[model samples]
Target: MPLYKTITPNSQTTVKIWKITESFDVLMEEVDLKPKSLERVLGMKSELHQRGFLSVRCLLKAFGYDDVDLHYDENGKPYLKDGKHISITHSFNFSAVIISDSKIGIDIEKQRSKISIIANKFIDYEFSYLDENALNYINKLTIIWCIKESLYKLFATPGLSFKQHCLVIPMSDNEQETVAWIDYEAQKSRYNIHFLEFEGFTCAYAIN
Candidate 1:
C-alpha cells in the first residue's frame, strides 16, 4: 500500500508511515544489513520492530545514504555518517520516520484503552477539552502517549519525565497539533508537535 501518510514540512523535513504486516519483507530488502546490524535486527520479534528497522533503511535510501554505515550511540539514538538528522518509531503494526534539516523525532502508537489507566502519570493538566463524563476515549490518550514519545525521541534524554516536564496544547482530539517543550537548567526550547491517525494507530512528529 502507499505510505499511510507523507508529510513535507517546508523544504527540509519529510515523514512517512507504514502499517506493519507480514508483507514488510518487500520493504526489508531495501536495507543493507551488516553482520553487527543483523544481530540487532534479529533481536526484534514483532512486526512493529521489523517495520521500524525497515523505516530506518528506507529513510536512508530515500536520501541516497547507506544503512549499513549508520550506527547508534550509547543512548540508542541513530546517527548518520554524513550528519543527517533521523528519528524513528514503531508500535504494533505501524511505524514512522522523520528526516530533517535539523534534529527531529517521530513516534507511532497503537491506540489502546489502557492509556487512560496511566493518564495522570504522564499528563500534568487535566485536558479541559476532555469531557469529564467521557474519560475513556482511546484516540485522545493515544495522542498524549504519542506526543510524549515524540518528545522523548527528540530530546534523547532518558530521565526526562513526560508529565512534569513535557506538555502539549491540544487543538483537537482525533486531529490536532500540539506544542512540546523541555526546560533544563537555564535553557528551554520548544518544538512544533504534529499528529495524525491511520489504521488504528496514532503517529506523532516533533521538529525544532
Candidate 2:
C-alpha cells in the first residue's frame, strides 16, 4: 500500500493520500468491494479510473473501514455508517480522502497549464489578485479550482455555482493554508482550507 501521506489537522479530522502504482488487477484483488462497487469499477472504461476507484477502497481499508460501511446519498455525497463525514478525490495517479467529526471535503488535481483555459469558468473574485502573466499562474489557478471543488463536496448543495458562490481568500506565496467562503441563498459560511503540492499534483481540503 503506497499511503503517501497522512495529516491530522485537528483531533477530529484526518487526511490520507495515496500514490497509485498498482495495476487494476492487483488493486481489484486487494479490496473487497460491494456488488455495486464491483460492477462500477469493472464498468469504468479508463484503466486509470478503474485503479483510482479501487485505490480508494484500499484507503478505506487502511482507515479500518470497508466498502460495506460506506454509503452515498441521493446527491452522491459519501457517508460512513457511523456518521463521520467523508470526502474523496482522485486525479491522474493520486487519490485522497478526508474524514472528520464535522463536514469536510478533499480534492487532488494535476497541476497543468491547461487549467488556465477554463479558469474563468470556475473563478471570479480571485481574479482581483491573479496575474495571468505570473510564472505561477497555472499553479495558482489549479489551487483555486481544487479549493472550489472541495467546497462543492463539503457543501453538497444543489444550484451552487463555483464561479459565483465559492470564494477563496487571497493566498500568499508559499502559503499552505487559507480561508474560503460560500455565499449563497442569503447564507454565508466560512471554512479553513489547506493545500499542498507534491510530484506536480495539488491537493486541497476544506474543513469546518
Index of the highest-lDDT prediction = 2
Question: What would you estimate as the lDDT of candidate 2?
Answer: 0.95
List clash counts for every candidate, in order. Answer: 1, 0
Relative to the unseen true structure, what is the C-alpha lDDT of residue 51 in candidate 2, on a scale of 0 to 100? 91
Clashing pairs in 1: 20-93
> What would the per-residue lDDT of candidate 2 be over residues 1-208, giving only the tens digit for each residue?
8999999999999999999999998898889999999899889899999999999999999899999999999999999999999999999999998999999999999999889888889999999999999999999999999999999999999999999999999999878999999999999999999999999999999998
Give the TM-score of each candidate.
0.86, 0.99
Report every candidate's CA lDDT. Answer: 0.74, 0.95
